[model samples]
Target chain A: MKIAEIVKTLDGSVILGKENLEKDVEMGFASDLMSDVLTLQTSNILLITGLSNVQTIRTAEMADITCIVMVRNKKVTSEIIDLANENNIVIIECCYSMFKTCGLLFQAGLKPVY
Target chain B: MHFQYSIEGGDFSRAGNASSQLKKLLKQLNVDSQLIKRIVVALYEGEVNIVAHAHRGTIDVDIEPDKVFIRLSDEGPGIPDIKQAMKEGYSTASQKVREMGFGAGMGLPNMLKNADKLNIESEPGKGTIVELTTLLR
Candidate 1:
């Protein structure tokens, strides 16, 4: 599914990467653990994480995850948005819990990264 | 090309600086995308290892036509048992590190899995060194 559809499905707001709204996301990986995120080899992957920190952005950068869905209404700081923009990653903010966000995306045909 | 970067222990915000730089360099050198991805992931994990566990550290990168070598050495309370530390899901990181979504003990395992070759040496009460090699061609 494209990032735009995922946003619509999850009622998420785009915080950055307006250009990436049409980019297609092939898989989803949800984790609060940065280590787990780094272990996977993927392309066009979406990272669903509630870990609100600069390291979350760093982890996504290292892992080449294209889009991030911040769950549980996690605050997206300016530093985080700046870093994401620098890395060319798209950040989406959602109020749903992690499970609900994943379920919604899965119902919309997003595959798992694993 | 040879490059060196200094890592400040406990500085989580700056953990991936070296990895990002090396990634750009590798891309400019036209390293294979798969190889570059693996190398960067392993290097980033090594970088975070120092930031999360060490006092301070240094990273050395030596790139050859066939392979790239990286060494990370840190000064800190070293791991007393290398075998135990290498195990997945074992971590010594403090609560703060865990709260940042790390300290899950998958760092070394990811490095080992991603790098073409991996070597680790540590001295108890002193520090540790990690060496990783990845082929570029």
Candidate 2:
């Protein structure tokens, strides 16, 4: 799915990389634990997480995950957005809860790449 | 090329800056993505470990045409049992660190898994130094 579609479906706001709304996301991984995400290196995966810290961007950068959807209506700070911008990763804030966000994406045929 | 970053312990916000910078360097050099991923991931985990658990540390990145080496050294309470620390889900990080979405204990194992070569030397009370190397053709 395209990032724009995910944003529209999830009612998410783009925090960074607005220029890449048309980029395709092949898989999705939802986790608050960086360790689990590290264990699953899904290239270009759409990462959905409740964690809204700068480390989340760092984790995504390390894993080469270029898109992040923040669940539970969590607001990402400017620092996090700046990091995402620097890493060239797209950031979106979703109003849906973590479980619902994951379910919606899964229902949309986005499976785990790992 | 060589890059050095002084990682400040207890500074959670800036933990991965070194790894991120190194990734940029690798990208500019047009290094292999697979090797860059391994090098940066291993180095980032090591850098996070230093920032979250150590008193102070430094990350040294040595880049070459065929290999990238990272050496993280810290002066802090060393791992008493490296075997236990290496376990996938064991962590000694505090509640604060856990709140930041870490402390699930995959740091060491991830470092080892991502790097083609790994070496760790630690003294229980002295400090710890982690060495990682990734090869690129």
Best by lDDT: 1
Model 1 lDDT tens row, A19-109: 9899998899999988888888886699999998899998888888889999999988998998888999999999999999999999899
Candidate 2: interface RMSD in Å?
Answer: 0.8
Cα distance off (Å), candidate 2, residue B98? 0.9
Q: Model 1: how far is A60 from its true place, Å?
A: 0.8
The TM-score measured for candidate 2 stands at: 0.96
The DockQ-based CAPRI class assigned to model 1 is high
Error of 2 at B42 (Å): 0.3
lDDT of 1 by residue, B1-137 (tens): 89999999999888899999998898898888788889999999999889999999999999999999999999999889888888999889899889888889988988999988999999988999999999866
Model 2 DockQ vs. reference: 0.86
Candidate 2 residue pairs that clash: none
Q: Which stretches of candidate 2 lie over 4 Å from their true place?
A: none
